[model samples]
Target: MAAPLTLLLIVAVTIRAALYRSSLVDIISERVEVVSPLTAWKRVVEGLALLDLGVSPYAGDVFHETPLIIYLFHFVIDYAEITFMLADVITAVALYMSAQEYNKQVFRKQRFALEADRYPMDCIELIRSPKEMYYIPLKVAMFYLLNPFTILSCVAKATCGLNNAVISLFILATIKGNVLLSAIFLSLATYQSIYPLTLCASALLYLMQRQYIPVNPRRASFWWFVAQYAFMYLGSLFVIVGLSFFLLGSWDFLPSVYGFMEHPVFLIFMQLAVISIFKSYPTVGDIALYMAFLPLWNHLHRFLRNIFLVSCVLLSCSALFPVLWHLWIYAGSANSNFYYAITLLFNVAQILLVSDYFYAFLRREHHLTYGLYLKRKDGSEATLVLK
Candidate 1:
């Protein structure tokens, strides 16, 4: 696994480095789909220049990145390419470890359920085996590193890659059941982008699940855990924000950096997808984050509806994005409507894909609980329908 991951990292780095040195760097950086207003490297450079001139980076409308990020690149602005590349590597490695730990927990829970004869006998085929799960971590790592979206973002030096790295670290920490690290990383991610704040509930739920804390109002232990986790998360966020304010000697970032879209949390996948699709200035890097998790649900393929159609739609839209952009911007033959149509279609395809997976997962859980073949009281076959 290490050897394969090493080779993949080297290959990913080579591709990014080549693109960084090539003439396409400017072209790639200027792409609307690859670099948004908030995460563009050029804006970061502009902000750095302002800081050097003893002016607040947020004084202008150009730079929207958080204070900590600007400070981070303040020192590493010369090696911006390496910084982006390193962020991608860190994200891939964190996701790899997270997948491994999550798989183990899933297998453990399945073993307990099987021992207790909790699952229906007809659900035997749905059980995941170690052989099938063996390479999932490597696959996850490969998905992140080899993903074209990830590569494009890295080459563009978009701060979205850095946000992805922080979110990945939060996921890794939560899966590993480290209470403090999970809170801290979650805070860091939330600080970077306000959308990540939705992850707080999910993380707390996951930690409570791991610790066997029942979600009952009567359980003192549950409330204690919730309070403790909230305190840590809020405390860390306060500290990070304070550090940023102290570094800049102003409160300008409170609005420029932290003021953005608010999202509701349903599941982690849906939350991520919503953020990517509905954020103020979305980019391909945002989409890449959620797409990496799709492989983890491959087991639900049998229950999925519209997988093929949705996949085709997504692929076609991804390919047409640049062509449509060129037509709208450069050729002037087409208009923003033409490009926006594709963008709308692309987002609709994403929504359909997410909805299909969510349905499939629920349906699989239903089958595992009841018999695969459901029957009514009259011994007639029953069909489940969404109301």
Candidate 2:
């Protein structure tokens, strides 16, 4: 199993790496054309740097939207169009399998080895007891490794779910009760986009689990989380101040980078997401579906967290885009940022459906693993695993 898995992983990664490298050529050149119906998708993403330059001497220069890691800015940020092409493409693929493998490895190595028994008796409780003889798919997501959704999402990178892979690691860590990891990832996700908060439902899990056993509320692990977010947003606040002074005139009408919270359209969608999360609790997969679509809430700067949240609400209100486009065409309301906002919305929706599919398949694999477990057990207390 190890050798074959290793070989397959190698082959899969190689193929993906080659494709991403090729995509880089087009992305860097802006040769990656914005297809229509999805035209708003293209422009909105492209608008950020453009708006940043509106009042500056660089306004005449074309702005680029290739995403680059914050630390890579020394060489990349000034180039605009030549932004993080290679990174985004590679990160996209890495997000798919790397995330799957990372999560599964965490489970197999840290989870089952310790709490060997009481697995199917209660999947959640499996974390506490040290015994054997049951199987649980939630302990290891089956479809994540085998499923082609990651490939599909990669082939279709324009969407939010695909773009969100790296960041989703953070969201998932939060779900699994890794605080420092979650906060760190959340900070990264918050900077990447404001969309991750929709997955905030995972926070409920964290709060509950923290109190479940020996976790120390007073430990630095607990307070480390507070400081991490404090710094992330505090840094964002500083950026907002600088941006405020930078875009003094456009502050009122222009869409904010932190618009995930306050944009009219974004607000509505976020509310719907929250409601859906709570309402769908009865169905295991429904909450998963709701989460898969929640986009990242990043700070390009210039607004409050609340404001950014609202913008997400508006952009994701896909129902209003026709009117928005009409307004743009009529020179009424559309700005370059409008396109950016809407594309983020489209991406979120794409991720939701696809993620649910992956999660569902994981559930199916759980059923199969359990069937095997029932047959293999000697009815003795000892657990029999594939290994």
Candidate 3:
């Protein structure tokens, strides 16, 4: 396990180091497809320069990164390239560990279910085999490390990589049932970018299940768990925010860092729909992160309906994003509307893909609980309707 992961780390680092030394680093850093207003390395440098000159980084519109990142890079500016590469490695390693732990828990549950005959008799083929599950963790690490989106983000020194690293660590902590660690990392993520606050749902869900608590609103145990986690999460967030205020001596960052003015309600919902909904690289990295789980869900292939169509739409949007950006920014033949239209389509594709997976997972669970074949009142075969 360590050998392959070490090799993967070496490969990823080599690629990043080479790109950092090459001439493409500057070009890649400036490309809209690779960096956004909040995560661009250029903005961080500008912010650092401002901080050095005894001015607020956020005083001008050029720097929108959080105060923490600015302070972090304040000292490590010399090793900025190395720091980004290390962040990618940390994210990959954290994800690998989390995936391995999750797979073991899944197999344990499946084994218990089998022993208790909890599965439907006709659903024998849906049972996962050890042979098929053995390599999933390694594949997950590979998918994240070799993913072009992650590579680009790292090479461009996008601070999104650091956010991703924190999120990956949060996922790992949650899976390991470390409530304090999970809440801390979750708060850190939320502080970095408000979008991760929506991930509280998934994290709470995973934590509740790990503790064997039923997810019923009327149940005391469920509510207790929810309140406990919520308290920790919210408390940490408040502390972090208060610290940021004290450090900066102003609240100007609230609107800029959180995008409080523009689309406040819609921004939260939009970010919730696509957790990785950065302008470009972040979304792809999010897609790749989930893509690692597809093999674990191979049993769900038979249950999915629009897998192919959803995949094609996502692929087309990904391919078109760069072309549209080029035309709008360089060729001068297209406008922001054209580029934004593709961005909308891209996010729509992501939503549809995630929805398909949600459906497939639920349908598979249904088959496992009930019989795969459902009978109507008239003794005829019944089919599930998503709509």
lDDT of 1 by residue, 1-387 (tens): 789888989998999998888999898898877886677899899999999999998876767788998999899988888989999999999988888888887788889999999998878999888764678888888888889999999988989999999998988898888999999998898888777776665666667761121122110122223334564755544453444334323222222332211111125666677667655456889988888877777788899889999989988988888897778678998975676678778878887988898778778877888868888999778898999
TM-score per prediction, in order, is 0.82, 0.34, 0.77
Q: Which candidate would rank higher by TM-score, 2 or 3?
A: 3
lDDT of 3: 0.68
Strongest candidate by lDDT: 1
Check candidate 1 and list the clashing pairs. Answer: none
Q: Alpha carbon lDDT of residue 335, candidate 1?
A: 73
Candidates in order have lDDT scores of 0.76, 0.36, 0.68
- After superposition on all CA atoms, how large is the RMSD of candidate 2? 18.0
Model 2 alpha-carbon drift over 4 Å, by segment:
1-5, 20-163, 210-387
lDDT of 3 by residue, 1-387 (tens): 789889989998998898888998888777665676667788888888888899998777778778899999989999998898888888888888887887788788899999999997888888888765567777878888888878877888888789888988988898898889999999998898765766665566556651111222210122223344664755544453444334323322333543333212222223333444332124344455555555555666887888898779877877887787788778999976676677667657676766676677667767777777887898678888998
Model 3: ten consecutive residues of lowest lDDT: 210-219
lDDT of 2 by residue, 1-387 (tens): 334444545554565456556754343222111111111124333444454545431233322222433124434445422222333333333333333443354446546544665235423432322222111221122233223333322332333332244454654564455777767766665454343444443343333430011111110122223334564745544453334333332322322332322222222223324332222011111122233233221111212223344445534553454445555546777753464355345435434533343344344335323532344346544465796
